[model samples]
Target: MDKVNNFELGIIGCGNMAKAILSGIFSSGFLKPHQVTAYDVNPETAAATEYEFNIRMAGDLTNLTLNTAKLLVSVKPKDVGAVTDSIKNVFAPGKNTIISIAAGVPAGFYEKKLNAKAPVIRVMPNTPVLVNKGIAVISKGKYADKEDLEFAVKVFAGLGEYVIVDEKLQNAATAISGSGPAYFFLIFKLLVEAACDLGIKIEDANKLVLDTMEGSAEMLKKFNSDAGHLIKMVASPGGTTEAALDIFMKKQLDKIIKAAVNGAFNRAEKIQDKILHGD
Candidate 1:
């Protein structure tokens, strides 16, 4: 058994996202495994995480809160209330800060359940954090100060880039960055399938699609120009790229994407309403 060191940060849920956070923090040398403790509802999961990351496993929610000054509530949005209720008494105002990554859950929800003076930071982070290339949008609660926001930013920065946004804009962020990867992935899958249909080998199709996507992303990053500008740069008059782009434009791909993103945003708002009002 690995001897547990005193922990400064506690994770309330030991899911994939939490594990990604641990990996990023460890890789960045921002925090060691022993300095962090974690808890999960499933004993096996917690034990596996302890062994995999060499971090301590808290006996329960109460134990986790008691052991660390900063607590990350990474449970599902529906489970947030129960987790907050369990640790409300242990959470000390001005002494402890709670950062929540539960989608659609607001900081005020935690503030109402936990100590009013305890700072709460709400974050929406995507799955790409597993590769240390994710984007996180953070929002501060009424009780949270600039210092608290900065502290949360530093922790997330270990995973990737971060932006500070108002709580009202969190749903849009969730729709764009939170669900954006899946959209890109679907397009990649379609492109690969199209290449395969064109008689390319499966492996070659995958490589071609991925390399093209990677190169395009790098070009966009390097040029610091809007995607439309880059598209114009690539598609000359009477060119193959322009021909393909014309088909997409005629099919109203932009409108379809806009509607799909709006669908995600609306669903997020409805979920939050349900969590907040028990609708």
Candidate 2:
């Protein structure tokens, strides 16, 4: 029997990403620890999140919707409608500014579901946010204004870089930044494996590949050069770098990358639970 209390931020889903966001916002000092509460359909989950963050756990969605001035909806796309149904009746039209981090789901879907005229802000943040290095792409719904956008930016700013994009471009943004980390991680993993195959010790391979990846990024930024320019700089004629790069060129790596990114972009658009009002 958790008592209903006014919370500046009420979390609809208290999962890993939600916890990451909590950590970031706490570090940023934008919202006090006492100003946020977590709500989950599974009471045990709410209790667990509450224990970790020392925030109150809401016993029900109605109480959370009615009491919290702002809310963060971090549920899965398929579960969004159920959460929306439970809150729409109690949701405060002008008071609550809802921010969603659900992948693939657009802000418009939430707005249509609520029909309460509350502002909806959609965010796509990668898992890197767990380590405070994530990039979040945010897009505002029709009802969201500068104030709502400002609040959204401040929350994620503590984690990593955030860019505001048009709702139309959200899927492409998701493809590039949201799914981009996995692509880089896979490449790094393969590089480590390839180094091991070349007879390097596992420990040395791990360090070498990781350090090279980090240093390469730094070099690009420090030199104000694109990756193509760096490639040319590294692969001197008839050198080992040139030999390896020639193999990659023969494999059409650039085309392979473009196809992979394009696939992700198309998948992003199809993954949302987009239910219109009349449909």
Which candidate number would show the highest TM-score if scored against the true structure? 1
Assess the local accuracy of residue 178 in candidate 2 as a C-alpha lDDT between 0 and 100: 89
Off by over 4 Å in 1: 1-6
**Each model's TM-score?**
0.94, 0.93
TM-score of structure candidate 1? 0.94
Candidate 2 steric clashes: 0
Q: lDDT (CA) for every model shown?
A: 0.88, 0.86
lDDT of 2 by residue, 3-64 (tens): 34478888889888999998989988999889988898887888888888898888888888
TM-score: model 2 vs. ground truth: 0.93
Q: Candidate 2: where is the Cα deviation over 4 Å?
A: 1-5, 273-279
Model 1 per-residue lDDT tens digits across residues 78-98: 789889889888888666788
